[model samples]
Target: MADLIFYTNPQSRGQTVRWMLEEVGAPYDTEILGYGTSMKEEPYLSVNPMGKVPAIRHKGKVVTEVAAICCYLADAFPEARLAPPTSDRADYYRWIFFTSGPIEAAFSNKAAGWEPTPERQRMFGYGNYDLAINTLEKALTGREYIAADHFTAADLFVGANVNFMLAFNLLEPREVFVDYARRMTDRDAYRRAQEIDGRLIAEMQAQQAPQPA
Candidate 1:
């Protein structure tokens, strides 16, 4: 039996865990879900009531949420050194959740064309889209990665987020984000995950084939 089972569809937040699983080097089985399919089914929904992607089952325990799955996988396989020890746990947990919380909120707002005014931005807590980008830019300005000058799980979450941001042009291709994306994507594990996801996407497209218009 594999040590872990990962449930995700390549199209969703599951891409984040797919990158993480590569980082942790854990042996896992994947049951890809199709739209309006197994994702809302009884068994899968039981695993994640929210019906989210990147859910993991390990040692008979169910774990959902993207950041939690990434953190858990890193901790489970200490050999990967994807996270810092308890000594640096403060920074570690802080940014992982930060990326998931404020970053996501701001991104969602932007995607929905809900740009916040200065006061609204402050109330929103992500410090507006520009500040959010600036905050991340400042962090990556000279640092190769997030955390205490080492590549850790925090970087995986934060870095991948920047990449996603750039994908939608939510973030300008500034030097900092670009450099960070370059650094993050250069990782072998990330490259592997990209390859797998690419192939899976291609197969998905192939399955659709062509139809008369």
Candidate 2:
């Protein structure tokens, strides 16, 4: 058996893991779980009780969640330089957690239709959706990318989040957003993952589309 076991559905955030796997050039086995099927069943839940896709069993350890998986894969395959060295741990920690935390917060709030009034904005850690997005916009504005000043798992995390944000219209399509996503998605590995899942998501949509009566 291979040392790596990937549990994923092509339709979910597992697609990001698929891209990272491609970026790092890791060889592994994949189990494509169907929707509403075995994902919640015994063996599957053993790996991730929440039954979320993109969990990985690697080198006799199990890791769940996208950020954790990205961190793990980056560290596990150091040669890939997907993440920074331990010396850069502080910034690395900040960047990854920012992706999972504040970015998610801004998008989730907007998606919920809970636009914050000035009073409400003070309580929002991200300081309103556009501000949260603008922070990144400024970060990507003058630089080629985020922390490390080179492409790393940090970009993968933040880049994917930005893509999610734009896709949902949670973030306005600023020049920064467009240029950054274009840079990140232009990677061959990223494109390959997109190609694979684009087809799968399309198929799923087709099947679910209302039929002509």
Each model's lDDT? 0.84, 0.83
Pairs of colliding residues, candidate 2: none
Candidate 2 has an lDDT of 0.83
Candidate that would win on TM-score = 1
Task: Encode model 2's per-residue lDDT on 119-206: one tens digit a residue.
Answer: 8778777877777777777767777857786789888988898887788777789988878877988899998888877887787789
RMSD values, in order shown: 1.9, 2.8
Each model's backbone clash number: 0, 0
lDDT of 1 by residue, 89-155 (tens): 8878877887898888878888899978876666777878767767767766777667866888888
Supply candidate 1's per-residue lDDT for 180.
83
Model 1 bad stretches (over 4 Å)? 117-123, 211-213
TM-score (C-alpha) between model 2 and the true structure: 0.86
Score residue 204 of candidate 2 by CA lDDT: 71
Q: After aligning candidate 2 to the native by TM-score, how far in Å is the CA of 209 from where it should be?
A: 9.1
